[model samples]
Target: MSTAWAGGTDAILERMEQMTSLFVEETRKSMYKGESATHCEECGEEIPESRRLAIPCKYCVDCQTALEKGSK
Candidate 1:
């Protein structure tokens, strides 16, 4: 490989690393925190205890899926 091509590859890798770090920081800031709800806030369905223990979720699995789809 040419010397110039090697240098360009290193620059590209450094830029990719910077972009990945920024994305990780943003995702960390947006993650759910605090206590998990016992019931689905949207559908009023009872959220299972297992679900509550699994993650800090405010809605049931079904409702969460619908909300994600609608957002897109």
Candidate 2:
């Protein structure tokens, strides 16, 4: 490949890597750092283990979505 084409490709690859890193960092930060709640604070629904592990959430997906929607 020509030097110019190689340089452009390198720049693009670098930018992509940076973006991926940023996205991962943001995702990690977004996850709750505190202990996961066993049940939904708003509703009496039991929070699933999978959801708790994925994110230490206080509410189930449905309730969380509703709360968010209502907040808007």
Best by lDDT: 2
Using alpha carbons, what is the TM-score of model 2?
Answer: 0.52
Best by TM-score: 1
lDDT of 2: 0.86
Estimate, for each residue in 1-72, the C-alpha lDDT of model 1 and write its tens digit.
567786589789999999999998878556666788888999899999999998878899999899879962
Q: Estimate each model's TM-score.
A: 0.60, 0.52
lDDT of 2 by residue, 17-38 (tens): 9999999898866766579899
Off by over 4 Å in 1: 1-29
Candidate 1 displacement at residue 30 in angstroms: 3.4
> Which parts of model 2 are misplaced by more than 4 Å?
1-31
Show the lowest summed lDDT stretch of 10 residues, model 2.
Answer: 1-10
Candidate 1 least-lDDT 10 residues:
25-34
